[model samples]
Target: MNNTKDFAKSSWIALVLIVLLNSCGSAVKSTPPPLRSQAEVVSVGQDKVEDSVEKKLENVKIGDAQAYYYYQLAVLSLASGNIEEAVDSFYNAIKLDDKSPFLHTELGKALARKGDLSKAKEACEKALGLDPSYLPARTLLAAVYSGLNEKEEAIKEYEKIIELNPREVQPYILLASLYKERKEYDKALGVLNRWIGRHQNSEVGFYHMGQIYLEMKDYEQAARSFEKAIEENGDFIQGYSALGALYENQKQYQKAAETYERALKVLGDDPRVLDRLLRIYTQLKDYNKALAYAEKLKDMSPEDEEIDVDIGVIYYESKQYGEAEKLFRGYLDEHPENIEVRAYLAATLEENQKYDEALKEWEKVLEQDPKSFDTRIRIGMLLSEQGKHDQAIKMFEKTLELFPDRIRSYILLGASYNQAKRYEEGLQVLQKGLAVNEKDPALLATLNFHIGVSLERLGRFEEALTTFKKVVELDDKHSNAHNYIGYMLAEKGIRLDEALVEIQKALELEPDNGAYIDSLGWVYYQKGMIDEAIRELERAVSLIDDDPVIHEHLGDAYTKKGLFQKAVSAYEKSMKLKPENEEQVQKKLEEARVKLKSQITTHTTGR
Candidate 1:
C-alpha cells in the first residue's frame, strides 16, 4: 500500500485657487453727484473710497472667525496626536462654515483616526459634494471607503484624485493595491505603469510593480521589475527579499542563495535575511553554509526554541543524523515536556537505526499526550517494523477510534495486516477505510492497491484482477498495480502479449525495479520466447538474488529451452532460497535430472 500523506497545505496634489466677485448697485443721489465739477467730484470720490473700505471691513467681520480659529485648533490637535480633540475641533469648525470642503475633509481625517469610519466617510462625502475636485477630500474619502471595505467606491475616489493631479504617485499606488486586493491584475498593472511612467526613478513604484507581476504569476516580468527596483535603490531590503523568493519559487536555488547573500552584505546580518540564506543553502545541499546561517539565526533569536528544531532538521537532512539526534536530545533534556521536540528526537533516533530508543521516545510522547495521532502512528510503524503485528494493529485500531476520519490510520492498519500475511484482515480493513473516505483519490488508490494484493494472495484471481484494474483507473501512475496485473496474467498463462505491454510500461516507470523485470521475463516465457525469457530472468535475478520466485521463473525458462543441466541448477537455487515451494521445485528438479540423464545416454549411444 502506498503510504501517501496528504499535507494540505493614495496621493494628493494642490491646485491654484482663484476667487471672483461681482457687485452692481444704483443710488438716487448718484444723479446729483454727476452734475458736480472736478473739485466736487474729487470730494465725492474720497467719500466713496471710504465707504468701499468700510464695506471691506464689514465683510471681514462677517467672515467665520470662529470657524478659522477652530480649524487652526484642529490642525494643532492633530499635530499633537490628540485625535479626539482634533475631531471635536474640526466638527466645530465645520458647523461654523459648513460650505468649507477643506474643513470637512480635516474632520473626516480626525474621525478616521478616532476609528469612527462611518462618520469619517460621511464627512468626506460631504466635502466631496461641496468641492468634488478637492484632492484632500477625495484622498480622505478613498481611505475611508477602503477602511469600510467598499473597494469599488475607494477606487472611484482614487481615480478622481488621479484626474485632479496626474503627477501624484500615491493615488496610483493605493489604487493599484486595491486592484490587487480585488485580483484585477491587469488593472493593477495599468495603474503601476502610470506611476512608473510618471516617476521613472521611483524604487517603490518598481517594487510594487514587481509584487503585482508576482501575484499574476508573470515570473519573468516580476524578476525584471524586482531587479530594476534594487538597481534603482540598492538599499531596498524588501526588493531583495522579494527577488530571492521569486528565484526560490522557480527552484533556482543558486540564484536565491546569491540574492540572499547579497542582501545580508547590505543588510548586515538581519534575522530574516539570515533565515532565507539558511533555507536556500539547505535547498542547494550546501549544509556547511546552511548551518552557518542557521547558527546566525539562533544567535539572533536565541529565545525562539523553534529555531533549534529547524537547526536539527537541517542537520538531519544533511545526513548528520548523529549530530541531529544529539541536538534534539539536548533540547529535550531541558524541555522534556515539549512533545514536538520529543517527536523530532524520536524521528532522528529512528533514522539513526536506534529503533528501540526511538520507540521509547514515542512512548514518552504518548504518555504526555495520548491524543497525538502522529505519535501513535509512529509507534505503530515501529512495532510493525519489529514484527509485532498484533501490538501494531492495536495501536492503529486505537488511533482509528480516536480519529475516525484519519485516513492514514486505516492505510497503516491494512498495510500492517498485509505484512503479517493476514490477507483477509487486510482486505477488511482497507474496505472499511474506503467506506470512510470514498472520494479521496489518494485514499481510494491506496486502499484499492492493498485490497488487490490481499485478494491476489487469497487465490481470488478474477477479483484480484478487477481490484488491480480499479487501482489503475484511480491512479494510472501506480507502477505496482501495473506490475501485479501483468505478472498475474503471465502466471495464469493468458493474455501474454497484453501482459508484456503492461509490464514494459511498469518497467518504463521504474526501470530498475526487479519485480517488474521478473514480470516481463515471465510474460516472455509464456510467449515462447525462451532466449528472451532467460535473458530477462537472469537480469532480474542479478537485481534481486534473494527472490525465489525470480529463480523459479528462471529455471522454468531454462527448462523450456531444453537446457536441463541449467534448469536443474536454477531449481536447486530456488529450493534452497525458499523451502516452502520445495514440493513443486523438487518435482521440477527431478524432471530436469531425468531429462539430462536421457540426453547424455542418447549422445553416448549415438557416438
Candidate 2:
C-alpha cells in the first residue's frame, strides 16, 4: 500500500475540489464565529463533533455554495495536517449536500488518515452508493481498504473500478501490483495479460508480466516476456538486467555475460553490472576477461579491499600460484591482521609445495584463533603427508583435546597411526571414535571399516571378518567392505564360493576398479578356475600395471597352470616392481626356473 500521508498530500482530487470551490467564490467566512480552538478540534477525533463547530455548521443555509464553503474549509484543514478539523468540515459538507459523492469520498480519506478505518470504509461505501460510477470515490475506497490491510476488499474495489472503466490503465496496474504483493501470481498475470491485450505497446506491462512469470519459476515464458519488453523499448536497462539475472540463474554463463554487457552499454560504467560480468567470467574460467572486469570494478569501488582478494583467488584458480602468492603476500604485508588473506596465502604456499612456509602461516592463524579446528586439521594432514607421523599424531591429538567429539580428528589420528604401522594404536583410536559416535551411521560405518583394516593388519582374522560384516550390514553398498572380506577369505583358504560371490558383488558395484578386479581374479584362482583366473588377472594387470600384488597373483596363477617359463617371467616382474614378499617371490622364481630346466632336459633326453 502507498503511504497514506504521501497519497493525501498528492491528492489531485482534493486540489481540484479546492480550485472549483475557489472559482465559485465559496471561501469560508473569515469573520465566522470562533467555532473551536485547535485543541478542541483535535479532541473531537473521528467522532461526530458535538462542539461549537457542528452547531454553527448545522445552522448554515443548505445550498451548493454552502457545501462548497465547508468543503473548502476541509481541504485547507487537510492541507494543514489537522485531520480532526478536516473530518468535521467534510462531515458538515456531506450534511448540506448529501448527494455529492466527492464530498463523501473526501470524508473517507480524511478519516482514514486519522486512523479510523471502520468509519473511513463506511464513508467510502456511502460515496459509492451516492454515485456508483464515480471513479475517484472507488479508487479512494480501494486505497483506504489497502491501508486497512483488507486485501480481499481492496481487490474487489480495484476489480470493480476496472469493470467500470476498462480503458483506464492505472487500475489494472494497481490491481496487478496488489495481487503480486499478495503472492497471487496467477491473478497478477491475469490482470497484466488483460492490460497488455489492451495496451500492447506498454513496456512496463510486459516487464511486470515477466516478473510474475519469473516468480512462478516459468523461466522460458519469463525470458520471452523480458525479451519482448526489451524489443518494445531498447533502452530498458531493467529488462536487460533481469534477463541477465535469469540467464545466470539457469547457468547460461555466456548468455548472461552478453546480457550484462548489453546492460552496460545502456548504463555505462555501472558498478553492479561490471561486478556481475566479472563474476560470470570468473565462473567460465575466462581469466583474461575476468581480470579486466575485476580491474574496472576495483577502480570503481576503490575502498572495497575484498576485490583484491577476488583477484588473488582468480589467479589461484587459474593455476598461477606464484602470482597468487605474491599478491596475497603483498596484501598481507600492508594489512597483517587480515586472516582471510593470510589463509589464502597459506593455501597458495601449500599448492606451490612450500610446506614449511604454509605451516608457519597456519600456526599464525592458530595464534589468532587457537580453537580453529579445521586449520589445525589441515596442519595435521600436511604433517602426515610430509612423513612426520609423530608430529601429525600430536597435532590430531591436540585437536581431539580441544574438541573431543570431533569425528574427523579421530579418523585422521587413526590414519596417522596406521600409516606408521601402529596397528594397536590405530585400533584404539578408531574404537574410541566408535564409542563417541555410535548412533551416527556414516561415522559408524567409517570407523568400523577402519577397525576391520587395523584388525586385519594385526592378524586378528576372525575379528576382522566380524567387523567387515558389521560394515556391510551398516551400509550394504560399501564396496570396499565386500572386497576386503572376499580377499581375506580367499587368502585364508576358506569359504571359496562365498568369497567369489562377495568379490563379484564388489566388481559389479565398481566394474572398472582395478583393486576389485584383482580381488575377483584372486577369488577365481582359489576356486580352481585356472583359465578364468588367468583371464581376469591379465585384465587386472592391464588396468593397474604398477601394482606389485597383481603381478605376484598373476605369477602364482601361471605357476599353478603349469606355465613354468611364463611363471618365471611374472615372478621376476613382481620382484622388479618391489613386491613386499621379496623372499617368498624369490623362492617361487628359483622353483619356476628349476622346473623349466628339468622339463627341458627330460624332453630333450626322451626324444
Top candidate on TM-score is 1
The sequence of per-residue lDDT tens digits that candidate 2 reaches over residues 1-607 is: 6577555433422322222222121322211112344344333432333223444345545459878898878866765668799899988888889988777877876776666767877887998898888777778778667656677988998899878777666667678877987899888989988877776456667777888889888999999988887887787777887899899999999999999898888889798888898889999999999999999989988887778888998898898999999889888888998887888898899999999999999888888889999899889999999999999999988988888887777888888898888999999998888767447776777788988999999999999999999998998888999999999999988998899888888888899988888888898898899899999999999999888889889989998998888888888889999887799999999999998888788889984
Alpha-carbon local distance difference test for all models = 0.79, 0.81
The TM-scores of all predictions, comma-separated, are: 0.73, 0.65
Which predicted model would earn the best lDDT?
A: 2
Which portions of model 1 miss their true places by more than 4 Å? 1-108, 121-142, 148-168, 178-191, 215-217, 249-255, 284-289, 295-306, 367-369, 372-374, 403-409, 526-530, 555-578, 583-607
Per candidate, the number of residue pairs that clash is: 4, 0
Q: Write the per-residue lDDT of candidate 1 for residues 160-263, one digit (tens) a residue.
A: 87787776566777799889988999899889888777665667778889989988889999999989888977887778888998999999999898898889
| Clashes (candidate 2) | 0
Q: Candidate 1 clash total?
A: 4
Weakest 10 consecutive residues, lDDT, candidate 2?
23-32
Q: Which sections of candidate 2 miss by over 4 Å?
A: 1-148, 156-174, 181-183, 214-220, 250-271, 284-305, 401-406, 428-444, 466-479, 494-521, 524-607
